[model samples]
Target: MNKSNIYQCADCHTGSGTPQALQAPKVRTHLPSVTNYSCTDCHSKVVVNAGPTAANVTAHYAIRPTVPTSNYCDYCHGPNATSPFPARNKTIPQFAHDDPGWDGNATCRTCHTNSSVSADPLANDTSSFHELTTEYGDAFNGSVKADCVVCHVQKSPQFVAAPNPPHDISGMAAPDCYGCHGVNVPGTEAQKLHNPTPTTTGGCIACHSNNATRYYVNKSLFALHANVNTTDGMNNVTDADCKTCHHGAADGTMGMKLGAANSSNTYFCQDCHTSAGTGPTHPSDPNLIKDGLSHGKTDCRWCHLAGDSQPRPLSSQLRYHPNGPRGTAAGKNCLSCHVSANLPDPPFHAPGESHVSDLNACQECHSNADNHAVTPLTQNTPPLVSGLSVSTQITSGTPSQVQFTVSDPMLQIAAAQYQVTNSSGIVFDWTNMTGTFNSNSVTINANIDTSGLVGNYTVNVKGMKSAPRTDPSKPYYPLNGQWSSISNAQLNVIQPTGYDNGTVYGTLGTDIAGATVSTNTGVSTIANSSGFYSLSLTNGTYQLTASKDPEYYPNSSVFVTVTAFTTITQNIILTPKPTGNISGTVTSK
Candidate 1:
């Protein structure tokens, strides 16, 4: 390791000597003619004061290469274990040939060329020492491993000092596929052997066995699995292969237990992955299709994409929808996914029945709006008859009738029925009731026997839709179906000549037009201007009183008597209180 040169290139370069003196070449190093050396040992000590020279390798000229022959200079300058370039002499300026950063380990033909090129560079050549320059150049390439440690290391490219002992790699990482099949190239083993893959020609048990190299990494199983390349040359492993070679296999029938009873396996996939369906109402419940004949055959994502639970139609699978599988905006497609038979009227039958026609008409008899549940039409809404009115006076010799309007909100009522309650407490259905279809109003002749009495009668009217029930015992004569809604009116009977009617008149004040006049019989009427009021009382002596305001003196009751059907007059005035109005505005800052 001495800096002193035996063949003194300094003498030829700058040490005051010979033919090479005029030009200082970039390289100058030689072997001492007197020193012990060998052509077999390319590493024979000859420090490069300038660099390796012809004198240094002159001994290897006549030598023939042996089997597995390689570039001799690589032993000292390449990336091999024996390469001492890393710790070379400080002033020598480390390098192989011309370039200061030259790499001595590369395919020889890259720096040396011939047309007889073959796969093995060393075996293809047979040249003399002087033929070295003509056959081989001093060029360099950096694309490959700078030094040949990529091939020479055999196990790993990571170098370590010895005597303290290099790490065995055994406990570094455990059960990793890349631990043993590690590669730095960017391809598969089948593509390039130096490249990587999860492949193991001997199968899963081969690397997982006692004879396997015990090495590992600190990464998680998922990360390792995600990065594993299962390309060509991968171990021919299958479920059966694992079971056949396993001493302890996964237990349980429906659920997978990946080891002996409780002993968990390193393949910690949690048995079931937790990533597929994660929404709160993601339609992932298996029972959402409890008795589903077809819908139970797919993953939830097929229908619940973007979280809309109203599954789109996969008509081919269920055959429920007439149209082929298709999706609608925001999952509002309802009819295609629904195929239930429910109706609201009698002959109440399921759909696809003999009586049921167009399925689209479901809404006519049931709740059919999108997102709505099926509810019976009759139960949800009812037809109603309102705006009832009747003629008060029964004409002595003319026919009389009751007129009223009907509003059928449900449109279920096609006809109406009525009953007349007379003073005798006997109720009879109005058999002569006729309705004008367009206006939806009914006209029924009261058929009042004007000679019976002089009192009030009741007309009860109702609306209904025919129920078409098959049972003969059911009430069917008057009308059918259920009464959607009901209402009533009053009919008054009066004799124009026989009984005597009397009128009483009175005055409460000067400006009381709306003051009420009443009798104990519950008959009441309002007063006109000048506070003069009148009422007709039938054959009875009546006691009447006038109404007064809160500030007026109380009224004095009036008594009036009637002898015949004539007008009887009784006038009275209400007095006022002693208090007077005191008005003013009071303001404060």
Candidate 2:
């Protein structure tokens, strides 16, 4: 090698030791304790060219200490190795050399070295070594150490360095439990890890021993933890009892340990917070059942509003809980699930006639928590109307009937009424009707007079507990303040009667009596002795004709328009047949 090509110690090493070495030494991004080794520990090889070769430097420093398994490689390359020739253990698992920056791959120089002059393995690089601890520390925390078997089938590896401290379980909440164990408690793959059998010892063997010190645990143990027999709160457990399972040194008495070199040993408080019975279990707290009605005791959240940990205050749970059907946190009121479609299976009262569908008026039917056992019809509610109908189209100045059926739970319908509204939604007419009472419902027929009104209108009927009113300002108000649902029907009042009159005369100005005058609408009238014909029609174009059998030729088609309440006159001139038609034919030949 040329003299200028020789590498000096100051060219690669810096006094601060922050991985600022010029070449391959840049791979050490951070040296935690520099006092553990000296420069000669890695660069002990002496070359005839006055410097250590790149191959000699990387033979021991290629793989860093960040990898957990790298500790096995450090046993021989560390400063404690024998000076002349380090003893190597072949029993340690060997990593593939194709892994970049891990073995003898050429790509290791991309992140390990910074030199461009040399053609060695650690040469011509743009990147420097990055510390794994600084980039991914939170992911490898103590909590996730137990979750390693979720992805990797191989057990966790041993750590030569000190391990991270255990997580504080006090700050955890409900979601933290379901997040690791999964949403469906006994349904996820994590369930097998929670209560593993000796035959199916997949990941549990890491914490539990399967030999002479075997510990038998199964799903039934979770039930034992929940059946404390006290309804006051979580009892039969103390701070001292928790230490035996969670803290303390691992003894052969229990198959659990505080630490393991190659497997998970972490435990959680949710391992025992599950409910255990076939039917209704004990309430989370005694005060949660002060109401006479039964809120669901089978679900833990019915009393423990927070879903996990200690139960919330009694006042808080009751204020936010709802009655049966869906007794969860989303149900905040009795009517939230007590609708007609989702009513109780046995039903509190008779069906059909005894049911009232109310979204906001549940108190009018049931007594709520005050007296839920009483009969439902103890209180009166608004009436309901059904089968409302009227003629869709009618002539002006005509009379029509509006009919409907009204029913009340308390049978207190005192009066029924109907009203007519114009096209502009204005009520112009209101009338009262007499109702014939049957069993629980009443039938009503209201006679309405359109009189002079000519427009589209809507007719509505309603029942009330008080006398009906005609006051325009309060047309819908019932005197006793109880009102029924307003049911409506459509009405169209057409144009009134108009006259189409005409005089039928012969070509010689002679009057033709008994002539028939008919319109296209199937309305016809005979001419009087004076040859005057008349017919009633509405406002529209119509085809008129005057006909008398075989006498003078009938005037076939004539068009005319009649306005409302007005008279239209048209004269019809009919031609008589020639009595001498036979004499003219002989002269043409």
TM-score versus the correct structure, for each prediction: 0.22, 0.26
lDDT of candidate 2? Answer: 0.44
lDDT, residue 373, model 2: 27
lDDT of 2 by residue, 297-334 (tens): 22233332323222322222232112221223333333
- RMSD each, Å: 30.2, 20.5
Segments of candidate 2 deviating more than 4 angstroms: 1-382, 386-395, 429-440, 465-482, 495-533, 537-589
Candidate 2 pairs with clashing backbones? none
Best-fitting candidate, measured by lDDT? 2
lDDT of 1 at 89: 16
Please name the candidate that would achieve the greatest TM-score relative to the true structure.
2
Lowest summed lDDT window (length 10), candidate 2: 341-350
Q: Quickly count the clashes in candidate 1.
A: 6
